[model samples]
Target: MRLDKFLKVSRIIKRRTLAKEVADQGRILINGDQAKASSNVKIGDTLTIRFGQKLVTARVNDLKETTKKEDASELYEIIKEERIEDSHLL
Candidate 1:
């Protein structure tokens, strides 16, 4: 699955376009390497996403073209989450 699609299908980003935009801006990493919107994603791959002050890392647990809301959470397992303080704020 594509990174963007996987994000949406997994209910991580909420929208595919937003996922694409974030990926294009270099805010997403797969297996510790920067990834593009069209990057291929596979089961067990680790994804790190930057959302402003928060960083979330999740491991892909499953892949599906589409999933119900209740099943979305089963797609990825959150490994870690942290809030990063901006240096400019100091």
Candidate 2:
């Protein structure tokens, strides 16, 4: 599955277009390297998304064409989520 699609299907970004835009802007990464929206997503892959001063990291657990809202949780497992405070940088 494509990274953008995976993000939407997994309910990460909420929309495919937003996911794509985020990826194109280099706000998304895979395995610690920058990744494009069209990048292939497979099980066991690690994804990190930058949201403002925060970062969300997750591991791909499974891939599916379609899934119910209840089943969406099976798509990926959140490994870590941290909010970076700008004050810490000062």
What's the lDDT for candidate 1? Answer: 0.92
lDDT by residue (tens digit), candidate 1, 6-88: 99999899999999999998999999999999999999999999998888999999999999999999999999998989723
Report the poorest 10 consecutive residues by lDDT, candidate 2.
Answer: 81-90
Measured over all alpha carbons after superposition, the RMSD of each candidate to the real structure, in angstroms, is 2.7, 2.8
Which regions in candidate 1 have their CA more than 4 angstroms from the true location?
87-90
- Lowest summed lDDT over 10 consecutive residues: which window, candidate 1? 81-90
Candidate 2 lDDT over residue span 9-68, tens digit each:
999989999999999989888998889999999899999888889888999999999899
Which residue runs of candidate 2 sit more than 4 Å off their true CA positions?
86-90
Best by lDDT: 1
Instruction: Please report how far candidate 2 places residue 3 from its true position, in Å.
Output: 0.3
